[model samples]
Target chain A: MEHHQSKSFPISHVIGFVVSLVLTFGAAGIALKTNLSFKVIMWIIGSLAVIQAGMQLFMFMHLREGEDGKTNLVNMIYAVFMVIVIVVGSIWVLTSGHAAH
Target chain B: MGIKWDEFFITGDPLILGSQIAILLTMIGAVAAITYLKKWKYLWTEWLTTVDHKKIGIMYIISAVLMFFRGGMDGLLMKAQTARPEMEFLNSQHYNEIFTTHGVIMILFMAMPFLIGLMNVVIPLQIGARDVAFPQLNALSFWLFFSGAMLFNISFVIGGSPDAGWTSYFPLAGKEFSPGIGNNFYAVALQIAGIGTLMTGINFIVTILKMRTKGMTLMKMPMFTWTTFVTSILIVAAFPIFTVALALMTFDRLYGTHFFTVSGGGMDMLWANLFWLWGHPEVYIVALPAFGIFSEVIATFSRKSLFGYKSMVFSILGIALLSMVVWVHHFYTMGSGPAVNSFFSITTMAIAIPTGVKMFNWLFTMRKGRIKITSAMLWALAFVPCFVIGGVTGVMLAMGAADYQYHNTLFLVAHFHYVLIPGVVFAVFAGLYYWWPKMFGFMLNEKIGKWHFWLFVIGFNVTFMPMFFLGLNGAVRRAYTYSAESGFAPLFMLSAIGSIILAAGFAVFCYNIYWSIRYADRNISSDPWDARTLEWSTASPVQFYNFAKLPEVKSLDPFWHMKKKNEGLTLFDSEIEEIHMPSNSWLPIYMGVIFGIAGFLLVFEWHIAAAVAAIGIFAGLIIRSFDYNEGFHVKKDEIHRIENAWRKTEGEVHDHVS
Candidate 1:
């Protein structure tokens, strides 16, 4: 009788998940432990969260599997860029001249 | 925490007392009428609990029409108060309430519902789908919207309408400044409506993305469907920001938390940012559908395919994308500095390019084809010039320096009314005329329709055009009454007269609708306009399941192309399988009622009871969801029986005509 082989999970996905977890924990740990800049910790955490979201989207949501995957990805990126520009730019411009010391 | 019945009584005023009585009476009357007409069961089964998109859409339109009358009455009140100098007909506070309610109702209750209703009715049909994805959610969304509208109107009687502008700018709207139930009503009403809008957005996105028929690619989708998709996206991304803003405002009002209170370590500007973030996209959410309506009307009447279809689609998406960045343009007077202002100004100006592309697309659509200037087509044509002027002025106002002069002036009012009235409202009217035949198996009276169109267009321009001059001449907006010595009285009088004309036009339209429904030909042909979409391929007054047999699309103008090639042939197979549809449920309406009651209680500070009720209602919804009842389907033989009857009638008519 022939033995049927079960499919294995991709090594890259495991690596990506592990890295995301480490980064998340590291950022939290740094914020908790250090008198050094907390803002830097927040930025690192935020970036890590964004990356994790992307990884999950691609690896889990199967965003890149369909015929329209490239188009959908591009549209999402554009939307994200627009969002960042609006939110960040609004804050920067509103505060640039009027920030109290 | 217990129910604060004593505190609720303390907040009461006589004005509120009076209005409450009036609202109660109206509700009683409505209930009595429903009972008298023997429509209780029918309303419950067909309208309130219906998961059918077309039925839900019709209900939405009915709700919006009712709200339009309420909002229009508010507008007339404002006009009446402002008509004469030092007019003591209404107090300043009353006038403020009137205008605020008008703005709120017109945008939220009237325009949004109307557009959404049109989309719900038409998008699935156009895309060759049986119904929208998540039909039950669609019903819930409509109920949510209805509940919000009900809450908003109820504010007039219960306490007072929101006195702050529809924008509800803070400092004025904050708890310290606005210590009343009015602002609470605004917050809760919008919160409820905003949820509905958000759900609708998600529903449409899912439907458009996942439920299009085979061969109906994105590029090949109708312009209206494209607009629906983009508008849904706008709703998903933008409405959440509004929800957050409203939630914060609610917290500030109810819990003494400081989100927008300036002295309480909160920023008023944050409210402005959040509101405008949603506000700007909201303009496109309304306008894009209007654009789509024009595209369809122009193409069908002109006997041509929509010119620059790809560009038009891209332009809609572009506009949706750009709308978010340009919110700051609304507040150039806030001292955002030249750099910030310039960035917003340039972005706002950039939007004009895509809008311009759309304009040219419409004009070219009418350039060389056999144009039939029906009432709907006339509205589309009138929209061209009216919306162009509005769009141009929009760009003008986008210039930071120019906006300084225009901001908070009647000019800004004129510009928006120009766009909203002729652009959004007229497009809605045109769509109603165009699709009435399909929805109701009868044509509206062309003679009466023409009267409505011409009178409306002329009166609209007359009413709003002078406001531009008034703004330029230094007249401010939101004033309850102006003095004769202020040199603004003549223009104000002119505007008031123009408003009367516009009201007259609306009256004519109402009359036409009434008359046409009573006396017009009952047997309207299925493809009355010989249009392109899948909707025209179905029976007039589309059956409950919509398509008896699913249509096979061969090209962009599937119905039109098929008719030309195969001599009015359909590829729908006679052998139809059992079609599964969603069953009607009372949960959505019940949920809406619970929310409405909770809102009323919260607005009056009856928090504990309201919270209990809310939890109970949600629990009921969850329990109801577990009770799955499979919907019945029309079998193949039943479909054939219905189709053969329709065919025989059609054949008899054709023979008589020939």
Candidate 2:
């Protein structure tokens, strides 16, 4: 009889981490230096943050390796979709409605 | 340099002053009664300081029951005031306080704690674990919750409870509007309770993840365990957002900061966003466990495996995820536009799919199986139709366009009460009946239990059903009194009548509990209901150390399979090993008391002293953690003696059979 131990991590995680850092700082720098619209800068930074969060999920949290990894990934994506609908939808509606003005 | 007692002790109105005096006397009387009964020592030894999950679970139930009475009193007050149009039993401010406190205490203190407590007692035992992963943390969490409960109740005597709704929607909760200690109490109490909830969540997650015996894989775990796991994850992820929101609100109130104040560049919508961020998941956090309870009870009483076990688990997860998105739907009337409303509306409706899947699974579970109409089973079966109605109406409300007509009306009230009463409260009742025999040695009286169930179901429907029609007729919520000329008098009277019936149901429930304890014959059989879980493999009143030797898990229904395979073999084998358990300590109580004092002081703005008290509490907790009280184990001979006695009883049974 042998004890079964799952493999903990792999090398692709390192690549993901490096890429996340580069994109995060790159987005921050662009936002800081630009005289462009604040909304555009916000969009860029927000996108970067999302990517970084995703990278962390995959690399550090090992979202893709467990027995239920695929299921978990799908769940995470669905959760993200719901989060966007809530957060974004709330701002859009409240701002545009006659009550706010 | 010194404390300003005069400023802190200001009493605004004579009514508030009178209410405070009455509450104080009641508390004093309760303390005196406890002392007179000579139950002080017993309470301390068995309940106050015990870390046994079952005992802790019992304590949680007791707390919820007590809080329910308090919250219910608040509800009755609101009802009496609202029984007629423009009837002036209570002022507008007083009515606001009553309803707000009722909603907050009932949801946060009564329902949540009761569910969590039931889960704490049953989940580990169901999953074949001796205790939770972190036993000390479990004890601490209960105390924190108790302290929070104390703070919430104390507000009645000190000033008033939070006048803002349980949602604590800002601009109103902001300092410019709410200038008293009520909001402070709300913030601090929730912060404390939220921490306990978070810790309990982590503890359960660890218990489920790390403490499962061999072969009890993720999917093989009980439906109750699955629900606990999902609910715990929701707690951990969402409760922190509440903590942050409360902290920011506190800053605004206490420090003249403008986090939520409109004039100070504080965005009120930020509060909405943050509060709902936590609030939406919170509804599911409460409901998911109930969902799990129904799944277990439905299958067991029906004599079947869950119809779709995997789908049930996935649905639990799905609801947990979708809940976070649907928080915005709550505030659709707050002027978020059609596009935003439509998005939230769709996401909210998406929640119905998972919920529908669960309902079908429960129905399918009952399709062909031999159904036993036990009290627990009755609640579960009733919950199906009741919750489905609630669910359908929920979907109706989720349609953004339709919500304009429904927002803040008695219709919204009817919708939630429909879901909450049948959805959460009934499920809790189901769990209580289903697990009562396992937790206690004797069965709860089935006749009385049935009476409780029926009265509650009928009363609940009567009470909330008419509110739907009232809301449709343009009746608003949170009104102290509506005018007779408002054309809502008949509905109000109907609701009032319904409330009285509901109160009668609760009274019957209390009496039933008393009668069951006194009259029900104590059956000492370990598997009294022929339960499938590992919890039933122990003695009727389970030992402090749950299992003498942990049983080997071979299948989903391990105990059932074991009994079916070899009825002669004992559930426990002769491998007696020393069991390590945590020793009881007074530190948890001590820390709870100190923090309780600190919260009281902070609410009253005893700033410097409050900080000192908080530091002292933290220091005591840290010190207690370092002082080890490693538990001594029972000798092998004691274990042998107990085993032999059981074996002897078994031999007598066998002899009789021969």
Candidate 3:
């Protein structure tokens, strides 16, 4: 764990890059070659997107590195929750219910 | 070159013409006085280019006070206009402009910068940091805000003031409706200031996070520091939305884009959503700091450590988070239906719980403790009950079904004033009085401060309480006058009288400052209040380098603990060292001027000239980016001398008191 904390080489970066590549190509291949329904394709791609974001947050940003790591992680999760509530909630309410349309 | 000379000159109204003349004369007089005194260089070196957070904070306070005067005058004129039925004190357009400027200047210029000023001055000292993380950037923030304010202020005498409203909502704010450069000033000025505020947010966050004294954990930080941290987060998250919203509005108004136009694929509600998305959090950006200030004042005066310190921190964070989600409640009647309104209603009401927790914490802190009735504590005490009234009415308005009846009425007006005046305004006064000795070297006159407090509180209640009744009796806002038969005459008259009284209260407060500065004793000790915070551990009118030796924090209220244990209270045992301070530069002022020029030119549709000025701004930025003048340092001998003098004075003060 102590050795891993030192970024004197590119091993972690390479691993993160390779994993991101596989996820991206896997989703693209499913969309292009597979005859899955549109909803199913969207689900797969969306899950892939979430995984990519997590990778970026953990591997690149080092969300859990210092004393503030836990606070940072919690705040990020809370921020995501708020964004979802705002964007998804706005779209849901605006497109349905007693909206003007 | 699309300027219309007639509209640009802003002629026709005698009242406006008189005011324009008065403003011009004032400007000339100020310049002449400065020139006669040969103080231009002194002003430039000491103030305009200084990177000291304390000096910058003083500049912010002065500018914000001037703006408060301007906004207050606007308020008085509006009240006079509506004092009686068919009053002709101001015409419809003039009334519209006054109220619009009043709202914009009061909130953005007066309240926002006033609080930010206090934060800049106090936060660094509280956390035992030498200065903010980026001292030069802090100076840049102040200059930008000042330039924006100056540009917006000139709108009254030149061109015209924005008449659509402070919100500058769609269609009405579009070019077809407001063809002049008024709304353009609103967009460009706010954009400039908003950018400044955003930099300040980022600056303080980095400072508080990375610059704390040793052993001062997040949980061990002062309440003001905690509040500043959370407020900074809110600023970072919320200001960008405003930046985008204002930019879109600018494009729509100037370039004829349809982002919020009624026709051509434009959606009006998008502006509302984006505006409030930022606007709601902007309230807490001003408010949470007030909460922090109250916590400090309450604990100091009550002679107790803050009760439920962890809970207070959580409540502040909770309010910050909740502030974002509750923006939709502002426009619940915008026809998003029960599903949307109910969701927002619940979230809006949920905010009250955290806020209530904070109120109770303050109460419990004061309980069974020695409570000093200082002016600062008086303001804090007044804030509790007044803010509760505002909060309760807020919950009432949060009910989706009931809001239809209360929306856009004087009741809405009353509710917000209750929140803002008591919450933000009272807190600023409390902070000013509490931190007066630190900022200056002397205390404010307590007797005069009491006069300022009582008059302002009574005047505030008198001004706003009647609006609730009048609003219930079918009185609407933004109306210049109502018919005599509408039966709002008595209440309107009463409210206008209350405004005059409020103006008097403000006048007394200003006078108190003048009197105190002239006569207040300067030989007072550093710790006048026997306060528990770290800031109080320093000398009054703190040195250029805040602390000669950085304190080692062992617990919460570190100073109090040091005093109680009679250990390490003074740094006489520690060796003095050279202190590095950021060098002052003229780049920020240059950038501010160019930005202001660009903004003014854009308001007149001089795109080419504006573009050139914009390039100059970027050039200033580029110079700043490459500049290698890191700073200068106070020599060890100089530090030793300053520290010796401070100790001598401390000894004298202790002798005189004992």
Candidate 4:
């Protein structure tokens, strides 16, 4: 694992990049191509976003590159938590029950 | 699209006219004094262009104090206007403007910077770092905040103060309702200041994480540094939401986009949701640091280590996490439905658990300890009961069902003041008193400081406490006056009297500064309080390069251990090398001035001039990218000389004390 990371052009980056692209276009395709409900579409997109973000951080951003790697990863996770709480909570409250049009 | 000269100048009110003259005279006086004293070059080189964190902290503090005075005067004016039945000291519009400016300045301009200022000064030394990770960026942060504050302040005389209140909620603050340039200051000035605060947050986080001395692991670090670290995290996470919110506001007002418009497919409640999303954490941004300062002071004066140190750290982190979810309570009455409100209400009340832990930690730290009752200690002591009152009322407001009765009333007003005055303001006073010697090499008078504390705390309670009863009696906020038959006359009169006493307390505090400069002894020891933190290990009024040789940290209370062992007294056991420091540059103030001009122009809808000024801001970035001045160095000999002088004084003071 250590030797593989020291490569000039790692296989992991290529695999990560390809996976990220597939995830992005796949989510878009499911949204535009499918006849899914809004709730299902949102769920798919949100889960895709989380996967892509995690992949990017570890692969592209080198979140595990330094002595502060654990800290950086923890911070990223906490930030993701805040984003999920705020976005999902706001949408849920605003679009349902008494707040609904 | 333009304002005429007569309408632009704020011509009518005599009170505003008086302040206009005062501003003019103060400017002219400052310029004349700088020139007459032949200190223009010195001031420019030392203060304006340099990237020293200590100097920047002093500048932040000075501005916070001045803004405090301005905000306090606004308070006095509002109180005076409502002192009697149907009083006409200020008409309703002017009253609206004053209260709006009061809230904005007190929170954004005053409390935020005051805490940030303390964090900037103390964090480096406490962790044994030479300076912040990015010194030049720190200087830029100070200038940006300064320029933004100036832009907000000038609205009083030039355009007009924002009258839709500091929260700047939508539909009320939209162009349709507030068509004048007044609300524009809110959109532009806060954007500038908010950006600066976000940068400060990032700077301190990197500093604490990367710059601590060897063996000073995360848990070994001081409480103040821990608080700063957490506060910086809060700032990074929370401030971006505000920046986006303000930009949406700017677009809705300036370019006629409908992000928050009443018509045009806009959702007004989106602004409220976003505002509180950022706004709730903004409370902890100021508050967590105050808790840190109180921890340091309480531990020092109590002659005991902070009780439950690990628990204190966890509780602060817990508060930061909880602060984000609880914001919907700010507008429970907006009818987001029982389910939504219940979710928020439970999260809001959950905050009390961690806060209660912290309160118990402070009290337990003092129990059975040899507590010295100094001015700083008094402030910390007073904060306990006072902040508890605030917290209990907050829990009362947290109940979604009961909030319908308390919304938009003086009860809300009283709740915040109880929290802020004790939690933020009193803590700032305690910190200033505690750290004054570290900043200036002299002590504040204990007698005078006590007088400042007593009058302020008593007057603070007298003013805000009655507002709760009045709020329960159906006194709504933002009402300019009350009828005598309605029976709010006497309580308001009492609150007005309390404000006068509070003003007197502030006056005494200022006078103490002047008096101490003249009379306080300069020969005191570095560790006059015999404190346990690494900050007290350095000489008073710390050196520019904070330590010659960074002390080796072995424990949480490294300095106290070193003192007890009677070893490492010189703190220069290691060899000295040439110290590299960042070079002073003109780019920061240049960007601050030019960006402020852009903000001013944008406020008045001068698109052409504003665009031109906006270009000047980018020009600063261009110049900086090309500039090759990395920094200068303090030679080994210079370090030796400075370190020896400090050690000699330390030896003499220890001898004298013994």
Compute each candidate's TM-score over C-alphas. 0.90, 0.87, 0.91, 0.93
Question: What is the DockQ (computed on Cα atoms) for candidate 4?
Answer: 0.27
Q: Which stretches of candidate 4 lie over 4 Å from their true place?
A: A1-69, B1-3, B571-574, B650-658
- Every candidate's DockQ is 0.18, 0.27, 0.24, 0.27
Candidate 1, pairs of clashing residues:
B19-B157
Judged by whole-model lDDT over C-alpha atoms, candidate 2 comes out at 0.81
lDDT of 4 by residue, B1-658 (tens): 4557776889888999999999999999999999999999999999999899999999999999999999999999999999998998999999989999999999999999999899888999999988999898898899999999999999999989999988988899999999988999999999999989999999999999899998899999999999999999999999999999999999999999999996998899899989989999999999999999999999989988899999999999899989988889999988888888898899999999999999999999999989999999999999999999999999999999999999999999999999999999999999999999999988999999999999999899999998999999999998888899989989998999999999999999999999999999998877778788888777788889988878789887887777777655654535788888888888889988998999999988889989999999989999987676768899988888887877777434344222
lDDT of 1 by residue, B1-658 (tens): 5543454432355655665576779889999999999999998888889999999998898898888888888888887888888998888888888889999999999999999999999999998888999888898899889998998887776566789999999999987878888899999999998899999999999999888877788888888999989999889888988999999999999989888898997888889988988899999999988888889889999989999999998899889889888898989888877888888899999999999999999899899999998999999989989988898899899999889989999999999998899878999999999998877878889899999888888888878898899999988899987878888888788888888888888888899989998999987677777687878777778777887666777678777776666534432554467776778888888888888888887877678878977896778678775666666677777777766656556532223211
Index of the highest-lDDT prediction? 4
Classified by CAPRI criteria, candidate 2 counts as acceptable
The alpha-carbon lDDT assigned to residue B34 of candidate 3 equals: 100
Would you list the clashing residue pairs of candidate 2?
A93-B336, A93-B337, A94-B336, B85-B482, B85-B483, B86-B482, B86-B483
How much lDDT does candidate 3 score? 0.89
Error of 2 at B35 (Å): 4.7
Q: What is the TM-score of chain B in candidate 3?
A: 0.98
Q: lDDT (CA) for every model shown?
A: 0.84, 0.81, 0.89, 0.90
Query: Which pairs clash in the backbone of model 4?
Result: none
Candidate 4 interface RMSD (Å): 5.2
Best by DockQ: 2
B437-530: candidate 3 lDDT, tens digit per residue: 9999899999999999998999899899999999888799888889999999999999999998899889999999999999999988887887
Instruction: Give interface RMSD, per candidate.
Output: 6.9, 5.2, 5.0, 5.2
